[model samples]
Each structure stands twice: as C-alpha cells, then as structure tokens.
Target: MRSLRLAAATVACLSAVALLSACDPEGTDTGDSAASGAPSAVPSTPAAAKSPAAKSPAAKTSATPAATSPATPGKAGRLPAGVWVDPKAVPLNAALHWRAPGPAKVLGEQGKLQIETLCHTRRDEYHAEVAMVETASLGGASGDWKADETIASYGSGADSSGVIQTTYALMGVFAQGVKDCAATAPGAKVTVVAEDVDHLFADVTLPQADGSTVVVHEFLVSNRGSIAELTLRADLPAGARPKTAWTAPADRQALSDALGKPACTAFKDCV
Candidate 1:
C-alpha cells in the first residue's frame, strides 16, 4: 500500500509539470505576435507626414520669380508747343527776327514767347538747335490759322540772323539748310510733326494706315539747364497715319545720354 501511494504522488507531479510547459509556450507566442504587429500601426500615425518636411529643399526652387522687362522709351509725355518758358520766351540778349515772301501773313503777334533749347540730333551728321516759334499758319491747308512753329537751326546759328533756306517742304519752322543736308542724297526729305503737345499725359495715340489709331506712350528728357536740354513727343489723332515718307527713329536714348542719362542705341531698342 505504501509503494502504491508514492507512485501515485510522482504521477501527479509529472502531470502538473507538463501543463505548466504548455502554458509558457502559448504566452511567449502571443507576446511575439503583438510586437510584430506594432510596426504596421506606425505608418498610419500623423507623424508619417514629417517625411515631406525633410524633403523641403525641392519645394522652394519652384517658387522663384522671373526677370522683368525695362521701361519703354518716350515714356515721359508730349512736348509743349511754342517756348517752354513764357516769361523768358524770346531772348533779351539775342537780337532775332523772321521773314517769309509771297503773302505769308504772320498769324499771332509774337507774345509770351517760349523757347526750350534742343541741342542734339539722332544722327551725328549735323549739330542741331531748335526753338518753338509762337505763331500760326497763314497760307497752305488753312487760310489764316494759329499754330506752333518750330525754328530748327541747321545753318550756323553764328550766321547773321535772316531768311534761312531749307530743302524740307515744311510749313512750320524747319531747318534753313535741309537742302544742304540732302547733298549726300537728292530727293531725301525729313519731316517731323507734333502729333500732340501737352504738359503731361493722357493716352498717347499713334496713327495707323487703316484709318485706325493705336495708343502708345513715348519718353522725353529734360536737362539741368531747362533751356539747353529738351525732348519732343506727340499723340496724333486716331486713324491718322504718319506720311509714308515721314518716319523718324525716336532717338530718345542718344538724346537723353547727350543730355544727362546713360547711353543706348538710338531709336531701336530704346523704344
């Protein structure tokens, strides 16, 4: 009976040990599965978007701006007809007078005269000087009229002041020696007209060939000596085309440089 009892106790101990081993294995496997599954949940976390910030350098490159174009020429405004100065219109020191033969009546009495000095020309071919003459057209298109006349100095300003001659068939004041300028080429004539003249700007209009008007602004220059440096610009009526034979390069840069600004090619890129 004693031997049987001892054998029974040993059998019980063996069974308990087997059960414990089975439970330990199950617990270890469960722990390993939970640890493995944790990595997948990390991808769904809000912190996942932090990766984009780490690559931020590429984002800034696309935001940079492009270069801009320079301002167009003849942008200031149109010229004022007659003299730029009314008080000092005609020169007090300089003795001056004018004459035109054959029923050319003087329209307005030369009063409150104004003269803005223009000292440069587009081409280096000739030294240029100009004065805005205060007068009107007597004969030609209109019978008797009041208009601004431009007195361009082509012959030597040093010459005795009197009737000067010009090749240009201009009704207003023109250079006296355009014919002399044409020695290089006969039948070559240059006519400059004031399409608009004002102290400031509105819309600038250019005449088109198809009886239409295109608005374009032009720039001008002024000098330290108000009398010495000046720029000319105009705004023509819409649908009025420039005469085919009459187009001039708006040599603003050359004139501006000769007056006070930086130099550039005349009439081409400046505009």
Candidate 2:
C-alpha cells in the first residue's frame, strides 16, 4: 500500500505537462529536510529520450490546403488521423465542463504525441474560475519505452530503496516553483501530502511578493508507457482547499492491456 501511494504521488508530480523539466538520477539528497524546498544540484535535462529529439512519423505527409479540403457531411471538427483520446475520455463532474482537445504537438524524434484539454469550473459567484489542464502522452516504439527509466530521470536518485523519497524531494522543488514561479523564490511553499511510484498528490501554496497567494492541486498517473496529468489551479480560498485526486480513464487502459485495443489501431505496427 505504501508503494502504491508513492507511485501515485510520483505520477502526479511528473504529469505536469506545462512544467516539463529534466531529471537526474545521480544527484539526489537523502535527508529529512529534502522536501523543504531545496534546490536540486542535478542538471535540469534528463538523459532519457528527449521529446524534441524524436520526430513524428505523421509529419512526413503534406496536408492539403483548407480551401481545397474535403468536408465530410457527418463528421465536423474531428481530429486528424493518428491522434488519440477525445473529449469523452475526460472525467465528468457537476461543477466542471470539458473543452475540446487542443492542437496536437508531435515529437518527431521520440515518436511521442501530446494533446491537452481543459476542464473549467467557476468559483464563488465568478470571483475566480479554475481551469484544469488534462494532458496525455502516447509513447513511441509501440509503448516499449521503459517507464521506470523515464521516471528515474525525474530524480529517482541512486538509492533504489528510496525511490519514493527522492521523487518527493524532486517534485517538491517543482511544485514550489509552479506556485511561486521560482524554486528558490521567496514565499514559495510546497507540501507533498501524498505520493506513490505511479501517482502523486500535492498541495502547493505560492505566496507572491505582491501579497497575493496562488494555491493548486496536482494529480498524475502513468500506466504502461502512456501518461495522464491533471492540474487544478485557483486563487487561494479561505478555509479548506478543494480536492484534486484522479484515476486513470478506462479507454487509456488500451496502451497497457495487451489483449485490449491499442490507441492507434489503424497502424499495423501498433498491433
């Protein structure tokens, strides 16, 4: 059970799509105060596969001009071939509404794919509104990439037994930076409320130099080689903070389940 918590916390920390930083495996600090917003001495970029280094296979084809594009009578606004996940895959909530998927960004060299969608919710008579970015990634090589090695890049350190500890320390730096805009910036505070190897849950409060505070809840999950990240952000509210726990979507299971359908069934190699 403890391992599960660590996995979940790690996933939440790693799933922040907008704040992608490279991790180093060797330079991890193993101390009780490691989670106290300490700056990691490790390099920012990890040695694992860099998304920008890999080229997408789909980019080789030329797209037709919009003026001469063929219109399908029944299908409008559909994603071009090769993209995975749709709005239906988003989790439902009474207070939240799902937005359409954003433009797909292809990492040609890594053959990885990324797309984002937003879930919007309003706060107390429109004083503030929260927008959660739901980001998902599909790995290349038919999802053969090493999940552990990829995760290790985000500060797993050299001690295999302390994977959870190192992950929390590394993630603490990231959460602090996200709320305060800098890891070492003044008034930045991050609390690792819960974590595991595959998932993470964090409560971050960034007190700006301007006297305002930004609070956020971050959740992440990784199954097989695919990843899903959700970040909930809003103004610091009085009283208790809102919950931001998340579970993997059913359709996303295809990436891991060998007997299940793959994300890109149309591709022969995906099978």
Candidate 3:
C-alpha cells in the first residue's frame, strides 16, 4: 500500500510539470499555434466576411448622371391630325363671334364638299358664322385633298370682326401631287389657282366689352380671294350660372353610340 501511494504522487507531480511548461512566465506559446505561416490552432473565417467587394457597379454608381443624345428640330406649330374635336361644345363667347363671316356658298362643280356653322344670340342677333370648301382633282388618289380652302371672319360685341385665310394641299402624301400644285399656284390662270389655297390652323383673340378675353381657334383652308366664315358665340347673361350654359350642334348620335347611352345624356361630362 505504501508503494502504491508513492507511484500516485509521482504521476501527479509529472502532470503539474507539464502544465507549468505550457504556461511559462516568459510568454512562451506551447499549444501548437503558429507565429508566422505555421498552421494556426484557431479555425478559419467564413465566406460571408469576403462579400463586401462582390457588389455590382450599378448599385455603387446610382448617383451618376446618364449620357444624353442631341434632340432633332421640329416643324412649326400646326394642328395635330386625328384629334377629334366636338364643334358644338366649343364656347362661342363675344370674343370668338366677332371674326367670322356669313355662311358660305359653293361656286362651281369643282367644289366637291362644303360645311357651314352658325351661332346666334337668343334674340336672333348673329354671333358667329362660317363655311368650309374641299375639292380634289378627278384623277387624284383616294382620300387625297388636291385643294382645301377655308375663309373666316369673326367679331366681338354686336359689331366686331376679324379675318383669316388658310389652305392646305394633301399633295404631300404623294410627292408628284404636291410638286404639281406648288409649281402651278404661281402661274395658274384659273379663278381658283392652286396658290389661292393654304390650309392651316389659326388662333385669334378678341376682347369683350367688359375687358375680359376670349380666344378662338379656326380650322380652315384659305385662299387669296373671298372669305366666308363661322363664329362661336356664348349667350349666358352676366352673373348667370356657368353650369347652366349650353353648347350646340355636335354629332350627338355619334357620342351616344360610342358610350352606349341615350343621346339626351351622351355628353353629360362635356363642358
């Protein structure tokens, strides 16, 4: 029993010596750790630690300006085609009424189509009046306007008037047609020479008796000759309710058919 106790004491002393060797006061590292390039006892870091540099360039450059191309020049202000405007709903206040002429009349067989518009006050006083004339050559392409003419005169108050002329040739649709018209307008000997017509949009302003302003837009073909016009007029009395105002003569049937409603309420939303 004495021999056995001595062997156990010697084993405990050997363990203490090993521990003391591992933790020397001079800072010796004895756990198989590397100081330089030797395998470290600690484990390596995860892939998530390397993710910051993997971001996209677009996200990092979000605040930079984009390069732009130069813009192309455009034509003068002209009416945009295919825009549907309801004639009856246009307000014919005193400002627009003073510039239009009396209703138009056709002159010859060459005049293929015509349209007239008139507006008057409740007491039969004429407020606005105008007409349109359209014609094409016998051999012209389908839906082509060889000649379109418009004449308009408008006035403000009971006695004001303004005048405008415009004509447009759809000859441009076919290169040969427009060239023929433009070449002939200068030297043509007919009463309605090609040069007589110019088609364009006109915007005019007329002043009212009370110092307010009224603006009018005319869609017409003009000639160097006679002018017959239409005027837009308003009949609402001073201080009258604006909501009670009425517009006239639009294709109510077309509007009703489009909305699947009765004609009486077809344009309830139009002002």
Candidate 4:
C-alpha cells in the first residue's frame, strides 16, 4: 500500500508539468503571456499597427486671375490750338487779330487755327503784315491747307557735302508765281533773298509808274508742323532799299523759339 501511494503522487506531479508545457509552448515562464489572456508571442501585421484615424491631404484649388484687354492709344484727350501760339510774343506795336471766324476748331484728337494776324499796318506811305497759323494732329489726317506739301518737299534729297539744301526750289516756284502776279498787276518782283532749315526770307520790289519803289520783306517759318508768315512792307520815296537783312536772322530765331513747344502738351491722348 505505501508503494502504491508514492507512485500515485509521482503521477500527479508529471500531469501538472505536462499541463504547464501546453500553456507555454517554449516551456519557459515569460510573464507576458501568463499575465494576459491574449497570446502576446504572435506579432501583429504592419497594416494593422497603423493609425486608422489618420487624415488624407486636402484637394487643391485653382487661384489664377482673369485675363484683360490691352489699352488703346490716344484715349486721353485732344490738345488745344491756342497753346501753339502766344500773342505776347508778337511785336509790341502790333495788334492781336483773329483770322478765324470763331474759336479754335477741334476734331477728334486734332486742332486747327485758320490765321492770326499780329500787325497789318496799311498806310499810303507804308504797309506791314505778320500772320501765323497752327495745326496739330494725332495720327489723323493733315490740315485742310496744303502747307504740308511744302514742308514735305523740303529735306527730300541728299547732298554730297551733307548740307541740307534749303527750300530754294520752292522759293523759285514762288518767284515764278510772283512774276505771274506782276505780269498782270505790273512792276512787281519777288525774290527769295535768304533761306534756312525753317525759314524763307523774301524781298518784294514794286516799281511804281511814279518813280517811287515799294519794298516788302516777307518771312515764312515752320515749327513742329505750325506755319507762320510775317511780312513788312514800306514805300520808299525813290530808289530806297530794304534794311531787313540785318534783323531777319534774329527775328526768325525769336519766332522759332516761341513756337518750339510741343502741341501735344495740351492733349492727354498725345501724351
């Protein structure tokens, strides 16, 4: 009986060891699996370990601006005609006279003035005259009068010495016209005495049947498309010559300086 009891106790000890081995396959007592009901020995998948609540990137929105049209030229405003002429620049003894019937004529971005007379001294013994006309155009048609033809005809040829040939050709044509006038009216001779880049000075000699000589001085100037024609005439007792040669150069320069300002200044579109 004592031997049988001892054998029974040994059997009980072997069964307990087998049960512990089944719970822990490695036969080691790592507290991780023993403390928790889950099998901590098996590792989780990589995808399952990631955070399920992580957010995705937001969608992009277009931020480009709309296209616009290009601006047009000469849209600002038109210049004034009076700005091209200053009456104060005329001779002190001269009077301000308007050749145009009305005020300055404005068309689109252009302006025009008919004629302005500074002095028209007409006496039995002497005669004098000074006149001016101005025209401004911004890409439109030219003035009604054909003054541009004369301006265009100038500087059209080349010179071997690089010196610009003055308006001698035009002056010759004008002299012919004066001769034609004299043929009808009698005793009139117009001669182009001097010419430069911007001016033509002429001497008109009229031989009256009474032996007195009528001498007239004429000057034509072009500045920035503006034209000014000045005339001074005096009747000599007999055989007297004109003294305008000495002062013609200085007078022409002064008139040129007076009209040198750009006509576009008065116009917004011109700017």
- Using lDDT as the measure, which candidate wins? 4
Tens digits of per-residue lDDT, candidate 1, 141-190, equal 11111112222211111121211111121111222222122333232233
RMSD of 3: 27.6
Ranking by TM-score: 2, 4, 1, 3
Error of 1 at 180 (Å): 41
Q: Once superposed on the true structure, which residue ranges of model 3 sit more than 4 Å away at CA?
A: 1-197, 223-227, 233-271
Compute each candidate's TM-score over C-alphas.
0.18, 0.32, 0.17, 0.31
C-alpha lDDT score of every prediction, in listed order: 0.25, 0.32, 0.26, 0.36
lDDT by residue (tens digit), candidate 3, 62-138: 22221011111251111111111223232332222221122323332122222221111111112111222222111
lDDT of 4 by residue, 1-271 (tens): 9999999999999999977855666667757665666674877765523744212100000010100111113422222333443543433213222132124233321111111111111111110110112232211111111111111111111221111122233233333343343554466666776666555566666677788765555555543322334444455567554332223434656764544332323222121
145 in model 3: Cα distance from truth in Å? 29
Off by over 4 Å in 2: 1-92, 105-185, 235-271
Per-residue lDDT, model 1, residue 222, is: 25
Ranking of candidates on lDDT, top first? 4, 2, 3, 1
